[model samples]
Target: MRSAFLIAPLLMMLSACAGEPTRMGASTKLVEAEEAILMPPPGSFSVAGITQKRFSNGLQQEIFLSTTSAVPGQNVVQMRLYGTRNDLRYRDDHLRFRTVTEAGIDAEMRGTLPGIPMKRSPYLVQNDYGAFGYAFGRPSPTELCMYAWQQLRTPEGEKPPFAGFGAVQIRVRICETGASERKLLAFMYGYSIIGAVDDMRWNPYGPPGPVSDRLGHSGNPIYPPEMTAGAEPDAARPVAVARPARRAVQPVAEPVPTALPGAERVVVPSPVRASSAAQPAANVAPASSAGGTIVPSPACVGANAATAAACP
Candidate 1:
């Protein structure tokens, strides 16, 4: 019993190391734990929008978009945290980086996430804090680990091989501005900590147990921010995507060749295929193929006949 008590203090220190300290600590990550936890927008008063998707593992992922959506792919972010002190480690030993040797560590397709220009991808990560690659820039170390951790865990609540996760937690959040409300933000707030099996960058112990997805099912229904009662496109909102404009295919009318050079100006005939039923006289291009036989597209008919480059 005395030995267990002595070890407990060391473990608590380690757990708190990964915990969201609301104050930054010594880590190479761009955003420190303090910065990540107290970063203003997610504070008590403000609630941002949240978006979630379920993965094949039955884990649900809830994402929060910031007030102003930055151009996608342009902004990169990571959240590194440590879990409860109960896992076992030193009193001040913060959650270490996630090691590939650890269980549940896996790779995935970027999905909607933009491609990291192959020229710019740190193709390999050393742990939750650092990566190896030949890119123009690398994300701050701490974030890399946290990002990896966030990517590993989903909202549907994917369980790792471990029966219970030890200290340290990490996550990734993409910010957006145009959201009508903050359901996404609330989701992230609720996601971190709470006896959850957190991912570690590197694990010293051989094989941790499995994560029980069904453990502590208490995170209840989320209350989104107040938006209009109606006309909000209320069913799983669709994102607005921009489209390119269409270009005109035909050129302006020119003069037709005249037999008597200077005598009279002849108007060129307009291109037209199938004319209206009311105007059956419209010049419809005779059907034919481009290379093999003459075949006409609807576009080759009617007033568009003049530009029928496909006609024989």
Candidate 2:
């Protein structure tokens, strides 16, 4: 009778435990989706597919596969976004290219697979949204690869812009065949965040700054320097006066008059040369001085007679 009572109590306890609902961890309770919440601008890339994993704690990871090829073998870009989450545990979580690359290599070597050697160098990437740490390498003669990561959160020692804390992590990996570095990095610079949490405090980007005081002020006009308030149309504007082209003046040759012993030497203008249609003129007439008349030397008769020998 005592053994039967003990067995009955144990059975009852087991049945009660089995009927209770079990709780799952936040990370393990994830819902799979296919919606695209983040993307680059239109025409920049063609989306092949999207995979989204939404966690129970309002965290989401979106992976995008993009086809950038026009022919058989072209560029391919893969982008991942860890949307802003209110959880503080993920605040310091960020991806590094070297660590991820080494992990991949080790996994391949452990599996007896050929490891791809990627020569990585620090690549600085500038973006309007935020700064990103990028690394690039050539895995093969025809394959180019780039990896970039970014973290957006409130700075240390600064209070949250709103009531709650928010953070975002972004990662991108792209490999293209015969693609230039600039072409591969264009996706990083041109991507945009289209999805955001409902709460205002969950903004990865802080509140917009105040408008400048100069804006809309009466004295501070926002027009180009060349554009006046009442400027005339280009066709109606006054035509600039074109000045007449000045002709170059030809130098007139002067004849050297023979020096007389008692009279001052005088310079006579050379006779103008006549065209072929007209008869040639005679030598210049002698110039009369106060003392007497002085005749020029024959050597200094023509326009070409400016030489010292002719003058002497």
Candidate 3:
């Protein structure tokens, strides 16, 4: 009985390390735990929109876009529910540097989570954090991870596969204006821990788990300040450019020719021939060949016509 009692506490400790804390909906418990240490986001910002995506493995990804009075663009924060396959190959730190450098992040900060191992990618550079490319153990109710990445000083147009890590990640970019490195880091820390906790609480596996009645509410939806103005917001949206129309073709006319100057005029008459009636009239009587004697015609009108001078 004593052995079983000791085993129970040991099992619970391991489970808590592997699972979400007792207060599922919030990361406060995690922060309270030594594993996480960060201040929560103050009333300065609120969630503007939530984009939720369900993957092929029945896992969910949620992106929370928040608007702050101190930031220019809406902060893009994401969280991937559950985790990835265990057998996937994790790239070396040298490869990780090469990858994110190619994607535009020039500098990186490396560290580990309290309970996770040192051999894995638990590091969060400038603005990147979350399940950093490795999966935690499965079936433990609260085991969730997230990541964030941003290329602040670098110019746009870096070939993707951004030099960061994670199998499933949530990225919250650092705002351009009205944002300091501290706030950006705070946001990264807040979301990587709390944002992931929020996602897991909202869409948990199997039976509905315990939720914080207080933190579960994601406040009222809001839009960016630029959109709240009374003008059309098409400038933010993409538009298609129309192509030009083609012109119709007109046909050419042929020219008429006149006779050339100084050319000789030639007249060619058509040949004429006597008809059958005229032939019979001219040869009314047949004449003897080389002799003055008259010859009779087979179709003679009168027998006297056949004789020479006496018949005519």
Q: Highest TM-score: give the candidate number.
A: 2
List TM-score per model, in order.
Answer: 0.21, 0.47, 0.25
Candidate 3 residues lying further than 4 Å off, grouped into runs, are 1-44, 58-62, 68-73, 82-101, 104-168, 192-312
> In candidate 3, how many clashes are counted?
11
- Count of clashing pairs, candidate 2: 0
Q: Which stretches of candidate 1 lie over 4 Å from their true place?
A: 1-47, 51-57, 67-69, 73-110, 115-191, 195-312
**Clashing pairs counted in every model:** 68, 0, 11
lDDT of 1 by residue, 109-187 (tens): 1432434221223345333322322222113221211123333322224343553233233344343333322333343
Q: Which tens-of-lDDT digit does each residue in 206-291 have in candidate 2?
A: 54569989897788867676798878667876879999999999999898887677755565434332222133223423335566
lDDT of 3 by residue, 105-193 (tens): 21221221233221223544432332223222111233222224432222233212342122232334333334443544455445334
Stretches of candidate 2 above 4 Å error?
1-34, 67-125, 157-164, 223-312
Q: Rate the local accuracy (lDDT) of all candidates.
A: 0.36, 0.54, 0.35
